[model samples]
Target: MFEACLDRGLTLKKVLDALKDLISEACSNVNSAGISLQSMNPSHVSLVQLNLRSDGFKIYRCDRNLAIGVNVASLYKIVRCAGNEDTVTLCVRDKADCLFLTFETESEYKVSDYVMKLMDLDVEQLCIPERDYSCVVRMPSKEFARICRHMTQIGDAVMITCVEGGVSFSASGKLGTGNIKLSQNSSVHEDEAVIVEINKPVQLIFALHYLNVFTRATPLSKTVWLSMSADIPLVVEYNIKDMGHIKYFLPPKIDEDSS
Candidate 1:
């Protein structure tokens, strides 16, 4: 059995919305450490990992490790019922087949409860080892989102070029080509400003749609980190306050005559 409480329900809401686009069902692992989820998209093009530490929660309890498979869409709908200041509690009994959710809003003088049926899922656990990417870019999440949104309108793929100058995002489509560059800033220092770090010049191409999908985290984090290498997938991570993080990995989209 386990019970976890989150102060602001919006954080959980954002996670669900971002996940709903790629996965319908998910197995959430609850343990003494915290809550975690690892899953791949149906097409196997992208993988997502989520972790929320126990201390991040106002109240957390777990007697034993538990894996509960749930319909994320239903869970998101239930979370939507919560008010802005509402506290959301997720709980389950020993080997219970249903997950109980309670929402409390004192100011609104409203309390809502929901019970969602769970399923037993057979999931394969993957050992995702740490990677050394060729280029790691840190920038404002909003700026990255805007670039992806605008460039996606011009092409089906986004080419990210990392060189001595900086990092650039370019796309070519029937509408013509679009490009956005963030040059290396050697002096500026800010938590939310654009920063680029590259060991050697490397270029990667990925589906524009996937990049746009990854941008769903813009609302949850001020800064976004992009790690890329030719031999490995691109890693996009968003650090949420008082929470762990949401990570995404998208395999590079390949084409003939593409470098």
Candidate 2:
């Protein structure tokens, strides 16, 4: 048996909305530690990882480890029926083939329950090696999303250059070329500041299309962390407040110009 309750139904809805575009279905592993999911997009060009700590939930319990396969899009539809302020609980019984969802209002005046069939998905766990990144940038999530949106409009690819105290995003296409630079802001609150830490300068090119997809997670957090290194995947991470974090790994485009 496994059950976890979130304080707000909207939180779960936001998570599903952010993932439905890239992954239609995936398995969520629940254990004593919490729940986690790691899946690659159908195109296999990028990977997404999510970790939700058990303590972060309003109430959580696990009798044993369980891997629950879910159709993300379908579940999102059902979750949307719940009110934003309602409490959301996900429950699974032993030897059951379906997952249960319950939504309740604070005043106990309203309650809703839904059951979704589980799937048997064969998903392998990948071993991600630990490595240090040459450049790490912490900036506002909204700003990153805006940059991705603007760059994608200008070109199919974006060249990211991280220098000492600033980072620049540039794109070139038939229409024209555009570049936007952001300098470190130390006066602002840490969450809103644009902070850059670099061991050495690095310039890399990535597909703006996938970067734009990653931006769908912007609503999950106020700040985003970008980690990049030569010949390695770019790590875009958004911490879910006290819950956990969701990270997207996208490899850089090699031997190609921004256009």
Candidate 3:
């Protein structure tokens, strides 16, 4: 059993929301993910990693060189209950039970029983073999979210085409065509909008539902980064403070006519 506590209540809320979205979308295959936390030397930078191991899904973890696919929703809920204060601490009682305790000046909240079901989760981390990617894009999280939402209105899938100039998000269905283009200067937030750019032109199609789930982490991060290759899987990285980080991988669509 493991338990942890956090001091900030708002951070807990954001983390929970993001995890919920991941779990809901990653419902297919096994329904859980493994989470590990390691401390940085100065105790300032914290590394929280979530591993979803699935033979059908794939992702590249740069540090461990591992590829994994697994359900992440259950793990998200488990972490959400771990702490609720500004300063969070975690503990494991046995191999199966985890507890999360939050402390305020005069009050405390115990959320131990919530993580019980996640104990039996069977998750594996694969060694990710190296593969050169053709394109990478950096954009505002909110802007990406807007593009996803807009494309979703047109069809069940969104076609993403990356070019040297920029990346284009488009969806076509019976309703016609819906497109959102982000260039090197696209801004999602006035004060913090990061520049968007791509290295080469690579086009891939992704499911709208998955995009929606992956972008849920946008509210937690200032910007979102995407790495892609032609007909290869798409990687979405979400950076969260104090809590941890999440990466989502979606297999590229081969049949555009069917999508």
**Which candidate should be chosen as best, given TM-score against the real structure?**
2
**How close to the true structure is residue 239 of candidate 1, measured as C-alpha lDDT?**
90
lDDT for each of the candidates? Answer: 0.87, 0.93, 0.55
Ranking by TM-score: 2, 1, 3
Which regions in candidate 3 have their CA more than 4 angstroms from the true location?
A: 1-3, 24-88, 103-118, 186-197, 242-244
Instruction: State the TM-score for model 1.
Output: 0.96
Q: After aligning candidate 3 to the native by TM-score, how far in Å is the CA of 88 from where it should be? A: 4.4
- Per residue, candidate 1 scores C-alpha lDDT tens digits across 87-125 of 989999986799999899857478789999998987786
Tens digit of per-residue lDDT, candidate 3, span 7-107: 55455467557656434322112122324321111221111224323221222112222112223455455555544443444333443333333334324
Better of 1 and 2 by lDDT: 2
Q: Tell how far residue 239 is off in model 2, in angstroms.
A: 0.2
lDDT score for residue 135 of model 1: 88
TM values, all candidates: 0.96, 0.98, 0.67
Q: Write down the RMSD of all candidates, one decimal each.
A: 1.5, 1.4, 9.9
- Model 1 backbone overlap count: 0
lDDT of 2 at 216: 89
Candidate 2 residue runs with Cα over 4 Å from true position: 257-259
Candidates by lDDT, descending order: 2, 1, 3
